[model samples]
Target: MEEKTYKIMSGSGIMNVIMGISAIALGAIAGVMLIYSGVKLLSNRQGITF
Candidate 1:
């Protein structure tokens, strides 16, 4: 019984690490996209002249 419990815990720990890494990767991608869009908007030089 003890051996089974240890195996389960080890498996869960690995899964948690994988999930954390994936979440960080996704967040970094989203942050980069946001910054790119913001810079594009800021650099637009066309102004409406009426």
Candidate 2:
């Protein structure tokens, strides 16, 4: 019983760590994309007219 509990807890901890890393990677990618888009818009601002 204790062994099973320890296995389950270890699995859960590993999954949580994996998910945390993935979330951070996803957030970093999104942030980079946003910055790139902003830079593109600024660079092309002269071509846009109201």
Candidate 3:
């Protein structure tokens, strides 16, 4: 039996890594924005008057 191994240093592989990193960064940014907006909305809310 023979075993084969492959390396992932090719151009497409590197591009895939970059794309994955970008997706993660974008998701983080979106989450931060959502939290920030929620906080802002809560802070600016006026309570109901009786």
Give the count of colliding residue pairs in each prediction: 0, 0, 0
Q: What lDDT tens digits, residue by residue, belong to model 1 across residues 1-50?
A: 99999999999999999999999999999999999998887787465245
List where candidate 3 sits over 4 angstroms from the true fold. 1-9, 47-50
Each model's RMSD to truth, in Å?
2.5, 0.6, 5.2
Q: Which candidate is the best by lDDT?
A: 2
TM-score of each: 0.85, 0.95, 0.72
Candidate closest to the true structure, highest TM-score = 2
- Write model 3 residue lDDT over 1-50, tens digit each, in one string: 12222343466688999999999999999999999999987987786344
Clashing pairs for model 2 are none
Please, what are the lDDT tens digits per residue for candidate 2 over residues 1-50?
99999999999999999999999999999999999999999999999999
Q: For candidate 1, list the clashing residue pairs, or say none.
A: none
Residue-level error in angstroms, candidate 3, position 22: 0.4
Candidate 3 positional error at 36, Å: 0.2
